[model samples]
Target chain A: MDSARDEPVLDVRGLRVEYRGDGRSVVGADDVSFSIGAGEVFGLAGESGCGKSTIANAVMRLLKPPAEITAGSIRFQGRDVLALDGRELRAFRWREIAMVFQSAMNSLNPVLTIGEQIGDIFTTHEKLKKRAARERAGELLELVGIDPGRLKAYPHQLSGGMRQRVVIAMAVALRPRLLIMDEPTTALDVVVQQEIMAQIRDLQRELGFSILFITHDMSLMVELSDRMGVMYGGRIVELANAKDLFAKPLHPYTEALMNAFPPLTGPRRELTGLFDAPRTADSCGFHVRCPDDRSDCSANIPDLREVAPGRWVAQSAQGAP
Target chain B: MTHPLLSVRGLTKDFQVGTVFSRRRVRAVDDVSFDLPAGRITALVGESGSGKSTIARCLARLEQPSAGQVLLDGEDVLRTERRRASQVYRRKVQMVFQDPFGSLNPVHRIEHFLARALVVHGHPATGEALRELMTTVGLTEDMLQSYPHELSGGQRQRVAIARALAVRPRLILADEPTSMLDVSVRVGVLNLMRRLREERDIAMLYITHDLGSARYLADTTMVMFAGELVEGGDALAVMDAPAHPYTRLLLSAVPDPERAGSYDPVERARLREAILNPTSCPYGDDGTCSRTEPVRHIVGEDDGQPHWVRCHLRAPASDIARRVLKATDDTEKAETTAA
Candidate 1:
């Protein structure tokens, strides 16, 4: 781990986001904070509407209207990203921090050739000539394992996996210090997902770039991340090293996620717990469905605290250690 | 033992791929057969273009099979008249799709979906009985008024399940039912299916590309490749022993935290290449696999039931040698094709 004093590649603190709805505000992210070191893969895992994606958008300064970062600080490479003006933010986007969205197939322009889409990145950031940009585009495609000669083909001409590679190629066009990928392989089949993940791992190793990988797949997160943060109901319920988190997940929600996925190698058993009724308004977010819920769970909202070395957990009705 | 609930024999489907005058035929689903035993889940596992979905579609009669028989309770439905087949088959087998959102109509309320199935299959004579079925699937009476878009993914899936149950079908064909759901919510849907199987004895054919879920849900698992069942038997045995090379490759590719640092990219590539190779084995003039084809070898006895595998490695020495030579030639062809 990098020292606390050293400048981190991406630092976020006291971050809170809200979605205004029907004269009331819905809490998307409440007091979330974390930092990523250089060449680190930070995983954010949660069920749908957990606000992990909202936090990523907040960091990127990409949140749409009505969904706003109500409070927080986002610093990229020691610069205040939230404080940047519109022109500065535009310049900072691809040059300093790039994004690879979930639907890479749709993210690329269908009409444009793969080379032109990638070339746009260099032209926009470096103000390169058309010929120079085309040359650089070929090099980027080659880096991602696509043949340079095939760059003239349109997006639809390539397979889903190849289009994802093209999106990755474009994201790293400027060699950004940080890359954020949202559910990058959720749409892919298992074999194709494995291939894409392997490519991502190799690129991270070679480029030494920091990544903020957001996905709901717990097993994938454990395999690829250095550190993992578990989110629930828009709160960071648990954060720890990948191995430690899987081995001994402190939060109730984290433990539930571990139990949900069947063991990859094991005897067959009829696994259950698929239909959990939603929690009542007064109860804790997990209380209604939690196997170990107590009466006190309905009344208190748990705060995340450091329970052990580099491990954090939410306070439960059973009380903190 | 009693006869299987659903028995398929020599199922085949072919598609015309190229231009009009010069036609090119693609054998999308070759001669394939399997059984869904009474009160048990069977998974048809494979990657894309492996004819897994085509098999499912044929079983559902969504696409007309070019040949072979789909026997529901010993009656050859494909041979039956089209109109009568729809009536009988619709009541016996219902399909749950991969996308929960797309399965339900966007404009209609949740109750309308369930009501339509119930009325079609002749159920819920009164409003009270209709609401009772809604509660049976864990949805409150209030949710009946909400549109499909208003519900969460998990809720929408439950509605889909409830719609299937409303028909009170003998068999349920769930095609990647929980693949689109959240990780936490996926278990909920799987558990619901298990409960239905136990309480109602609804035989399920759970088709999925995810082996982890297949291992969890299936009683008997069939591994499909290029429109053929390469390996099958008890789910536990197939997953644990995994006799075929393709089955082993699938198992190894699953993301496990325990084996994080042990994966080799080159090995994965080799396995992928092996799966993609066409003409790995020769079929006879009648389109049946040849006498030299890999035989189904019983690996071991698991809980008194025999575990089976279909691979050249498990076959006799002569077949193995033939397959080895064929594999070598295919590698050369693959290299030239890539070049």
Candidate 2:
């Protein structure tokens, strides 16, 4: 907990994003805010289309057309990331921060060898000699617990899990201070997912780098993250240390999400998630589905406020005490 | 047991891979046998390529089994040759796939989807029948006008389930039905299936890699590894005290906040390269395991029931070791009831 008080590696506030087209539009993120302290793992968790991935894209400045960051301030080492121009932004994109994408099958270059694909980053960015870049690629593979001898193997030759390990190795090739992993293990099976998560945590600990781990798997997030933020309908409903959030979820949406997963050890209780259709953006986003929602829940949007020493909940019924 | 509604006797399926001349046989479902008792959910739990899905396809006759028979009321499904009889067989058993997004026809309305299923099964495709199935799946009649793309993932899955029910299946094979759904909506689908089994008395074989859902929704849990039924018993017993090493591995991988710190990286990497060969035990095929294929050993049976396991390590015998194993199992049962 002491490390959270230190200077954050990435600070995000009032971040809002939208996907606009001809007649239809969506509020992808509304007033989402969080920070990742040095050497800390901050998990952003939600179900599909809850805008966790949208936040990751906003951080990387990788939003495609029609999806724009409407309002927000992202500070990396106290530098305004959104204010940076072409060259400064390009330099900051991968050097200061690295991203491991969600689907490893599409992330890797299919035609290139693992060594060539990884070495190209060093060759283009750092301007290292060809031989030196190849050596660095081997080191990256070794760090991820892969045999460096597989450097010459093509992506198709390797299995799905091995391809993801290569992607992680490439993401950490430059040894960036902060890394953003977007559902890194969502596509892998359970055993392979745990192995990849363990490898990523080991790399983070060894390098002393902060990470923003984003995923929809709630139990996985709690196990691997130091602190977590729960998102629902494009808004963060609660934020707290991982253990506290699991122990006592203050927000109604958070409670529902926790109960959605079947218990591995406890007595089996029937799960009750959202019963109705998702609500619109005008109201408290989860009001329609919340089991305990009141008429006041739809009156005004609840601002995310600190409710305890280190816990925060965005609900009309809870606040700082 | 009252006669099994659907009994699979030595079902096997093999696919030929590689070029025609150099073709090699890959046994997808190898000598698998299980019973779907009247209305119980028999969960076939395993990792990928463990032949769970293949068994589901075999039950529905989507793929011809290489050998063996699917018995319904002591008659073989394969031996029945007439087209009308086969149609009756299909009407008795229907399947629901994993991907709800891909399962429904994009261009068809919900009404058209369910109506077609009824018509194909020789029932009148009337508005009354369509509304009945929709209400059973907890969907409003207004959704009948909407396309498949307009519905949420959970709703679309319900539409698929409703169509399967339109045929009035005696047995439903749901192959990873909830895996593609979000964690929040997955439980709703499970609840619907559970209600179907209880109210309609429709037998279900749920094929999934996740054991957490199995224990919650299934009455019996059957563990499959490398296309072999490794262990099976009552759902509570299989989850609480998993006898086979592969079953334990699958249960341990489930993400539980309470069991967070028990995962070891070294152990995970070792289990990552799981069993591939059809004949060898996944843990390690010592000489006998590789040569003499093991058979099911009925371990414990109290009150005229059996806890069956297919493991070379532990065999049921009247000896000191068997007594020790039995003693620990009693303690496990006590702990389960206490919890």
Candidate 3:
């Protein structure tokens, strides 16, 4: 991981995405800020509707009308992502920053061959000839552990894991500096998921690309990420080194999220399931569900503060390092 | 010793794929057998196409097995009530489907769905009766009047469980009940299922790919692979010291915070390749896997609760056919004795 402290591959600051409808706007992502170092894996983890995907969409500039980026800037290698125009944004997407969605395997066109799909990325962005692009496609397929012979195979012909590999092959065709994978292997089988994660890790090491991996699986996020942010109720409540986050999570919500699923090997214990609660503006967003909720939590909102060198936590008090 | 609430023997299901001319039998569930004891949660853990769900469907009488004996409470339901399941059998065994959203009628209120099940099962459809059902699953009385869409995924699943309980079932086959739900709310449903087993003593067969949750909720865990029971034992013991190679592989693949950064791709690829060839043995290609059925070998036992594995590696290379026959006879004798 050749990370440079000065220049990050991607920098998202004060990002606030809102869904404006029926004369009211609901915050999908609120005041979120994070940066991915060069050749580093930065994870964003939260359950459904916690604005984790909203942040990913915002970074990719994929947010449409009704889903507005109300505040903040996204910078990729010091380039303002939000400022890119039609052609610049078009060139910026696959060439600079590529995204593999949650259901990216199913996103493939059934009619196109795997080779043809991978070739299309090169032909459109790199302006390579069809023959040259097709050759390059074969190399990309092999890079992701698929046989080059299967380049002629249709999307439906491939298995779920193979299809996802094809999607990943296409995403990295232009050698993007940043790859945003949103729950890339959630739908996959456990063993297949492990294989895919290993492949991704190998690809990142070889390609030297930063990954913005997003998922609700805390264990997976902790395993893959160098640094991660824990989101709750559209706000990033905690951010720290992955191992630190897992070993000793400061935020109550982060702790709850980790304990949500039972360990594969452990003594039987009660799992605390989180209740869905509306975020209170004047108080801590997670106070409703927080087991360590104090009476003062309802009076003051907690801000994400650097309690340690690399550990950042959002709590009113008693989160001292 | 008590008789199992449900005992499945040699259950198999085959589907015809391809064109009519090219039609051939594709075995989905092949000679799978298991027991669901009273008040115990038996988790059938497996990946996709592993036939865990098929067993659940076979038990619920939703999918008729091509071959098998579904013995319920010492009586064979398949033999007695051929073609369609009796209303009594239907009431005794209930199914909680995977998708809560798709399972419930979006057009109707939650109360209507619960009341319909109650009326069909000869239970009172009164408000208090409905409230009792809701309370059993830890839902409020007001939620009964709300539509399915009005409730969250977890709430809707509880309502589905409420509907299942409305029939006063003795056994529940929940097929990946929490797979479609969000992570934060999944445990609530699992805990509710646990409470049901504790309070109502309702036997359950939880079919899921998630090993972690299976270990958490189930008393006995059965690992299925390629339509075969590879391993079965006490939940915690099996998860802790997995005997079967396939079970070990599955456990290795699980994302554990304790085992982070220790992922070995080379080993995983080897195991995956070895296990994927469903026709061949994982340890070696001695033609034994393709030749004969692997006899169940008792690996460990705690107070007579045996941990068993169906693998050529574990089982001695003796007369497998005779051993399998002997094993079947022994199980039958034991079951008959219990009955």
Candidate 4:
């Protein structure tokens, strides 16, 4: 908690992103703002197309044509991340902040051996010779708990879990200070998912790196994150400690999202449905689906304000303490 | 105890892997058996490559089993149908695949899918019938006019389910139906399946890797591992006190926010290593689990609901140990001769 007061590892403020084509623009993220402290695991959660991934892409400068960061600032280690040019950005990316996308293991080149792929990172970034890079690649594989002997194996030869570990190993080879993992284990089975998450936690602890974890799995999000933000219609509606958000979610949408998970040990309850509507600039983004939305909710867009110490909620009138 | 709507016996499927010159047989589903009663949901839970989906495909007749009996209403359809499955058998058994994006034809509207399903099964594809099918799955009738791409993941899955229901299937085999959908939309689909069982008495075999959803929606649950049924019983009873070591490992691995900061990575690794390895049987000294098929052992029965486990730990009273020892001796002799 004390780290929250210090210089944050990553800070994003007033972030806005849009997908534009054919003379029309659709908001992908609206005024999103959050920060991760040193060694903190800050989780961003929303359904697909709700702008969680958009924000991640925006921060990584991975946005392409038709998708643009309309407004915002991303600061990494007190430096303007968006201001970094070609080489600076490339150097900043894997060396300072690394990103692991959904099904990253499947993205690995099938033609190359695990050692060759991992060695390429060192040879390209650090300008290390082939033999030296290969040695370091084996160590990275060992760090992620895969047998170093399998470094010579191709991606197709490794199991899905082992391939995922290889990706994680490659991502942290440079010991980046912050790691962005988006649904890192969604494609994995429960046992494999647990193993991967445990390995990630251990890696973070050993390397002292912050993580910007993104996923739609609420239970996994709560289990891993120190703080979390709930997104709806491309806007963050709630931000608080992960445990507090799970126990007492102030926003109605967050509460509904929590109830949607089928419990393993409880009486079965009827799950509610989430309504999807185009976002309106004048109203709160979640007003259409919010169960407790009032007239003011549609009349005025509520800003994300501090409703309690270290807790933030975006709602009209009733959000006030 | 009336007869179940669907009963599978000794289901087995094998796939040939490796190059043609060096082919190896991999048993995907081995001697699996289960029953799905009318108006009840039976969940088959397992990890990837654990034969859960293979079982579903066998039931749907999408794959020809190496050897098995698929009895629908006390009739063995495998023996009856020679070449392809009869249209009546296809109508009685329908399948819902995992990926909605892949399952539904993107070029065609939702109406085409449902109407064709009805017409192919000898049912009248009227506008009223289509509307009824849409409403039955809790989707609006207007959605039928839209293509699969226009709908959300959840909506597409519902459309897939609606198409399956349009034929009035006696047993629906859903293989990881909601796994691809978001967490918020997943429950709505599960609720619809539960409603279908209650309203239409449709027996369902829900195949999934998610233990939580199985416990939530299933009346009976069966856990599978490496193509074998490891544990099975009443859903609540099995989930509460899982009998097999594999089931217990799966349950412990499930993500629970309530159990934060209490993850024992070392213990998880040990359990996983012991269960997932193929060469060593964790509970036995002779590698019996790797070599021999597990025999069912009734561990407990409560209120006429029997809980059974198929593990070496539960088969101590049986003569399986002696038989495995004898088999191990013969295998040793054969290996020496081959060498």
Model 4: residues with Cα > 4 Å off, grouped in runs: A1-5, A21-23, A281-294, A316-321, B261-294, B312-339
Docking class of 1: medium
> On a 0 to 1 DockQ scale, where is model 4?
0.60
Q: Which stretches of candidate 2 lie over 4 Å from their true place?
A: A1-5, A20-25, A109-116, A128-135, A148-156, A288-296, A316-321, B18-23, B81-85, B264-291, B301-305, B318-339
Model 4 / residue B167 / CA error / Å: 1.6
| Model 4: colliding residue pairs | none
- Give the RMSD in angstroms, all C-alphas superposed, for model 3: 5.3
Q: Which pairs clash in the backbone of model 2?
A: none
Residue-level lDDT of model 4, residues A1-321, one tens digit each, is 464449899999999998999988888988999999999999998888889989888888999979988899999888999898998988898999999989998999999998999999999999999999999999999999988899899999998998999999889999998999999999888878888998999999999899999998889999999999998888898999999999898878788777677778876566665655556667655576656635566754467888889999886655432
Q: Clashes in model 3: which pairs?
A: none
Per-model DockQ: 0.58, 0.55, 0.68, 0.60
Task: Kindly state the fnat score of candidate 4.
Answer: 0.74
Best by DockQ: 3
Q: Is candidate 3 or candidate 4 better by DockQ?
A: 3
Q: In candidate 1, what are the lDDT values of residues A1-321, reduced to their tens digit?
A: 355237789998989998888887778888898999888899999877788889888888899879988898999888999899999988888778888887776888889998898888778778899999999999988888989998799998888988998898788888888999999998877766777888998898888889999998888899999999998877788999988999887766787777678776756565554225443346555765556544455554476778878888777636642
Q: After superposition, how far is residue B154 of candidate 2 from its true place, in Å?
A: 1.6
TM-score of each: 0.89, 0.88, 0.90, 0.90
**Residue A74's lDDT in candidate 2:** 90
> How does chain A of every candidate compare to the true chain A by TM-score?
0.93, 0.93, 0.94, 0.94
Clashing pairs in 1: A274-B187, A274-B188, A274-B189, A275-B188
DockQ of prediction 3: 0.68
